[model samples]
Target: MNILMAIHIGAGLLALPAGTIAVAVRKGGRLHARAGTAFFGSMVVLGITAAILGPFREPEPLSPVAPLFVLYFVTTSWVAARRRDGSTGRFEILACAAALGTSAVMYWGVVMDGATTPAGPGVIYVLASVCLLAGLLDLNAILRSPLTPARRIARHLWRMCFAFFIATGSFFIGQQDILPAAWRGSPALLLLGFAPFAVMAFWLARVRLGKRLRASLQALPERKLA
Candidate 1:
């Protein structure tokens, strides 16, 4: 248990910085790719460890399904990025099922059991809602098949950004006790915790709403023929 805790903490520490670097650097650049890869690796370890350790925590054990949420987002995002041809596969189907199942479990815990997560019911509700929405989006994409480049990029961007948000929130807000007493409950900490959402929104708009970006994405298929 101690060893698992150590590994989990270590992965979280690594993930926080790696995810920040991935978000900070220019997208599709070598630095961004390397940082994103590092972040993905660290998050996989963190998620696995957290899921395993959650059930054993003292006083009140955590719901293991929570960590799986991060895992689902990161994994699906990675797949979306890798499938440059905008193809869908069985994995997306499996991921959709996982997301829906997770949402159901979370909703049941909060509504039926009257259980609150460590961060409270509000966070759980938000997480559950996002999971449900993601699942629906997954189904839509699968049914639509061969997504547009812009849509695929949008999918990858939001999920990865959301995963980063989770990591940032866990560290900046959830672990505020590790900071100096003066910094505790500081507004700066709150901003840092939520900064990823701002970044995500900016990039999503760029991908989805920008005319130039849409044009470039549309040109991708034609360029391949030459």
Candidate 2:
């Protein structure tokens, strides 16, 4: 358990800076690619370790399953970015099923034991909605087959950004006890924790609204435009 905790903490620490770099750097560049890779790797480790450690967190019964959300988003985003052809396969079906199942579980938890759930009913409902939406989107993508370049990029960007948001929120807000006393409850910390949403919005806008940018992205090779 101690080993899992250490690994989880270490992965979270690594993910913070790596995700920051990935978001800040110019997209499609070598630096961005490297940072994104590091972020993805760290997040995978972090999610796995967190899931392993969650059962021991006596007060947070939902802890064990929560990490699966991040894992799903990260894995799907990575797949979207790498698969230039935008093809969907059995993996998409499985992910969609998992997401819907997760949503069902969350809803059941809130309906059955809302008071004891650590996230409360509101947050759990919102999360469940997100899972439902994601599952629907996955179903759409699977049915559509061979998504357009813009759609592919949009999918990757949103999922990856959301995953980063989870990581940031978990650390800068959820783990405030590790910070200095002066930093606790600081507005700056709050902004930092939620910054990824802003960044994600910006990128999604650029990808969807900027016609020239879309053309450029489509023209670039997969290796160059992740």
Candidate 3:
């Protein structure tokens, strides 16, 4: 692995654990904001590196997954920034579609093609698509409801976290040694490839659940919603 590539992968690889810790100390505070900026910056750099370094073995259109991912991140980030009044639902749909589309194509290649040994890439694609959809649905629900401060904040948090979370997951799975000695020819692993993703999902969920539990318990039971 190129030294720079390894560092890029390492930065993203560590962002989840570090982000989780920052959120635990300060869920929606200045520290979280700082962490968020760092995480997103790393993602942006990752995306750029992806497109530039995407494997060219695949055909022209299919070979551009890196640039396509970059486009996906940039477009969705713009949409979230301007999605006032829920007018930018199209962006979410397209992003999720792009995610699923790329994933499906990679799926065909990984499962059918003879080149990939570790199945991590295909698994990463599928899981990222699913997380993207879940986060999108959460935003959709928030849009339908009466927009309270709590709801708005949750919406923003989910949007940001899911995008970066899954982005980080795929980057790491692709770069790091996601395979064992057994699976040497294909990109498929014996279910261990899902470990990083499980960790990411747990971290994200833990951040939300821990905060809610703390706030709920502090309300002295009677005043807090069960």
Q: Model 1, stretches more than 4 Å misplaced?
A: 118-120, 212-226
Q: Report the C-alpha lDDT of model 2 over 1-226, residue by residue, as the tens digit.
A: 8888889989999999999999899988999999999999999999998888887876644466669888999999999988899998999999999999988988888889663355546888888999999999999999998999989999999999999999999989998999999999999999999999999999999889898877879999777565
As for candidate 1, its clashing pairs are none
Per-residue lDDT of 1-226 in model 3, one digit per residue for the tens? 3765676566666655554554455655677657666666666666665555556334532244544554465345434433545443555556656665666666667567733434446544564465456446545644564444344444555555545545544544543566464554444532333443454455556655767888878986565578
How far off is model 2, as Cα RMSD?
6.5
User: Root-mean-square deviation of each candidate, in angstroms?
Assistant: 5.3, 6.5, 7.7
The local distance difference test score of each candidate is 0.90, 0.90, 0.53
Give the distance in Å from residue 164's predicted Cα in candidate 1 to where it truly belongs: 0.6
Give the winner by TM-score: 1 or 3.
Answer: 1
Displacement of residue 16 (Cα, Å) in model 3 is 5.6
Looking at model 3, report the run of 10 residues with the lowest lDDT sum.
Answer: 56-65
Candidate 2 Cα misplacement greater than 4 A, ranges: 58-62, 112-116, 212-226
lDDT of 1 by residue, 1-109 (tens): 8998899999898998898898888999999999999999989998999999988888888777768878998999999999999999999999999888888988998
